[model samples]
Target: MRELACDVAIIGAGTAGIAAHGAATKAGARAVLIERGPGGTTCARVGCMPSKLLIEAARAAHDAREAQPFGVVAGEVRIDGRAVMQRVRALRDDFVASVFSGLDAIPEELRVTGTARFADPTTLIVDDHTRIAAGSVVVATGSSPSLPPPLRPVADRVLTTDTLFEIETLPESLAVLGAGAVGLEIAQAMTRLGVQVTLLDPAGSIGGIRDPKIAACAASLLGDEIDLKLGATVESAEAVGDGVRLTWRLESGGQETGTFSRVLAAAGRPPNLSGLDLAAAGIACDEDGLPDFNPRTLQCGTAPIFLAGDANHERPVLHEAQRQGWIAGGNAARFPQVEAPPPWPAYSLVFTDPQIAAIGQAFDAEEAHDWIIGETSFADQGRARAMDRAAGLIRVYAAPDGRLTGAAMIGPGVEHLSHMMVIAVQEGWHAATFLDRPFYHPTLEEGLQSAVKAVAERTGGTR
Candidate 1:
């Protein structure tokens, strides 16, 4: 067997692995990046890009459909699913090519590609043929979509986020198994594209991570276009002729049934730890096959193996994955003297009808505490009103002393809103000061000020 050596070996070339390679090399460590398949993130090829492409198509179609309402009567807005698929395919190809080209821009000495499995603590078998002896190893292997038991047998018609992207045509109707970020986004996007959609979740409301009021507002915006099966679980789902049948139990233990042309399983994701041979490296994985590592350092049980990204037992958001990757890469480069990376502040965005974004601890924490809470409806935002869309809300949560604990926004421009919150959370910005900071007039940013003022009022800031 051919053998090579490096200071660090990073497995999985998704967002985390890609970031780790650059960070490690910048830190002056020799690193090799190994990917089992074509290099690009789920966000690149499947999750974010293609999904958004589909959504944009739907949005255009929606606007055309509404043209008549504005006294500009037009003929039917028809969509050629094949053309949509073609555009998405071209975009996906370009995205993959761009990522690979960027990876190549790194010093040639810092990258390699192939499947890699642990041979031992500091050694790996690459592509089951070549061996790599490294000083330290970082596992950035990301997670895979979780498919529940009742739906697993229908893998042919039922799809995961990864599989749904490859489909050539849109389904006439889609049943989404989870109302979390993935399901909600696709459900609404597909609904806008003229597909009948149903979204089911075991949680009491959709976007379970967000505040209840925010989630409810989002659901309201979705309207009757998509049927919501909140607080429901599928008891069974099977192919019935050209469509599928689903029997579910509601939160109240009441039985319910439904049918659709396609089923999408977006329940969640489990870490990709199956073939790593963690046992050979003396690393410990939990019953779920995820490494038992320190959240701060990502150090697996022992002997220089570290976990990053979805492998570290956290929600698999891209930001968290990138943070873990950078931390693990830096730690691997520095070895024994490496100080652990700080605890990552959690953050994420759910891209449903009205996108839901949050930062810091999720809003459902059980701390009994004094808080300043404020909300601004999208109706109040000038930009949203101008866009003819005003069906969302923004909220800020602050401690009794006015420190920003968390912030969430469910509406248009959420991606931009999230960028500001990331800085606010990281800087520990005082709710009152940041909220009072000058905001561009008639913009969604006004929502930030409104939320801050609301929280301040709750904290008796007026006094």
Candidate 2:
């Protein structure tokens, strides 16, 4: 076999792997990036950008239909599914093109186009074409959507993020399984776009929300717009003529059935590590197949193997994935002297109406008895009332010493409001620091200020 050598070998060229290559090269290491398919990160192709495009279109339709409360008559709003999807695919192609421009710049000599399996701790064989010996390796193989076993029989009618966008026309009815971010966002968007949608989740929560109150508020608001089957397990799925028939059991042991033109299995995304012979490289894995690694350093045990992005099975979002990739690549360039990257506060946003935003740590009910709490409902907020869209909740948490701990919110514009809390947690800003700032009245900022003022009061700040 042909032979190649490098200081670092980065497997998979998704968002994380791309970042890894830059870090390794910047750290002055010879790095080879291997990818098995046409190069495009998941974000540009399916996850973030394209999905947001569809959501934006859905918002336009929903807004026009609901404008009567604002003393305006929009008459009739019609959804053109073909036109909507055409625009999504067209703009999605542009985003993929932009991403490819960067990938294309990588010199061919440093790029390997084949599947790679570990031959040893520091060696890889690429589809039997080339043997790569490297000082260290960074695995950023990313992940793929998982189809639940019960739904396997009707798999032909089931779609994943990987295949959802390829449909030429939107289905008249869709059954969305798993109410996590992906399921909720798609369910809401499709419902607004005039599709009959039913959202089912075994978790019994709307959007993986930690705060039960906010979760309930979100559920109530969204449940009005679509069928909600929380705490239900799919028992059987069958492909009927031109559609799917599904039977599921509720948490109370009651059975229900449904038929839909399409089924979206947004259940979960397991890492794409099936073919890589990790044990051959002396790396150990957990029962779930994630490597035993130091999260801060991104190093696999004490070995020179590093895990980054969704493959690590830690935080699967793009922002954290990109950050971990750089840290892993830099450490792989200087293996034995690996260093931990500086910590950043954790946060996540779900792009559902009455958006769900979680900042810093997820709230733990068992440990929250000692937390200083502050909250406000948008139903009474000025801007929300003025917009006729005020029907959600926001809550913040703090330590006794006044440090802003975290927040869980469900509100119309909480996606934008949550960033301030993200910065507050990241900078270790106290409640008093927030109270000291001037908040303009008749705005969402005023609502946030009210919560801040409550935190300040509880922490003994008179301001």
Candidate 3:
């Protein structure tokens, strides 16, 4: 077997792995990046970019169809399924091309092309050909679609975000399981594009939302567009003819059956840790196959190994993955002298119409009982009314000290509104702070401002 040595060895060349390599090198460590498959970040290939393309097309079709509210007369809108997929594929290729360029620029000698598994804690065997001994190793092997046990029989029929966008033409009908971000977004987009879509989730947790009000708001609004069957668990999934049939038991113990041309399992993506013989490396994984690691430093219990990205199984969002990757790689470079990265406040957005968003301390775990909640409705907001998109609510959660801790909303442009919310949470801005800021008239900011102002008034933040 070939022998090699490096300061840091990073498995997986996706977003997190790439960032990890950069940080490891920047920290003065000789780093090797390894990949087992075609090189490209998930965002560029399927997860984020291609999904957005499909959503944009759906938005255009939905807008034109719903334009009667704006008193605009329009002709019949026709969706060219072939053209839609073509554009998505073409643009997706452009994004992938850019990512590939970055991957290509990595020094050739440092790039290992094969699957890597732990021969020991600080040692890795790449496809049984090359043995690498490193000071530290980073497990950034990205996730793939984890099909539910019931769906395994009809695995080919049940698609996932990883395989969803690869369809050259839109299916006539699609049954999406798991009403979280991926399912909701895909189901809604497909529905708007003239496909028969039924969205179901056993947990009924829509958009990964923790705030009940916001979840209800999403359930109601999105329920109107698609056949949303929340709290339904699939008991039996079978391939029937050209479609798939699903028999699900509802939360109420009632059974319902549906058949569709495609079924997408968007419930979750477990980390890709199959071949990495972690046992040999003295790493212990929990019930979910995730190792104990410091979220801030990304170190695995002082074992000179780190977990980042979807592999960490914390937050699968691309930005968080990349953040964890960089930190993990840097720490791996300089083990024992590990330092946590500076903290940043939380922010996540779902690109559904009337975008859903949450910023910082969303569910309020141990401090739940202490949060002072303030809210405003978009039903009467001037800007939302003018735009004819007024149908949602915004809630801000503050500590007893009146500092803004988090905000949840399902409203027009919540994605844009999340930027300001993130800033407030990051800077530890109090309700009084927002009261001092300028909010223009006839704008979405005013609506958000009203919510913050309410929080300020509740906490005696009014000047």
lDDT of 3 by residue, 1-463 (tens): 9899999999999999999999999999999999988778888897899999999999999999989987898899999998999999999999999998988888898999999999899999999888999999999999887788889999978788888878889999998988878888899999999999998888866888998889888889988898988889998888899999999999999999998999999988888986898989998988877788888988888799999998887888898988988889889898978989775777788989979998998775567678888899999999999999999999999998889999999999888888899899988999998779888787998888888888888789977
Clashing pairs in 3: none
What ranking of all candidate models by lDDT puts the best one first?
2, 3, 1
In the range 1-463, model 1's lDDT, one tens digit per residue, is 7788898899989888888877788889889888887668867877778888877887788788877645788897787888887888888878878888887776665556677788789999988667999999999888788779898667677889888878888889889998877788788888888788889888877765557777677777775568887889898988898888989999898998888899989888778888889889987766777667778877775568778887765767777788888888898888865667566566788766567888775676466245566778888677887777777888777777878778777888888887787778778877766765668878877777777777777766632
**Model 1: colliding residue pairs:** 372-455
Candidate 2: stretches off by over 4 Å = none
Collision pairs in model 2: none
Quote each prediction's TM-score.
0.93, 0.98, 0.97
True-vs-predicted CA distance for residue 259, candidate 1, Å: 3.1
The number of the candidate with the highest TM-score is: 2
TM-score of 2: 0.98
- What C-alpha lDDT do the candidate models reach, one value each? 0.79, 0.90, 0.89
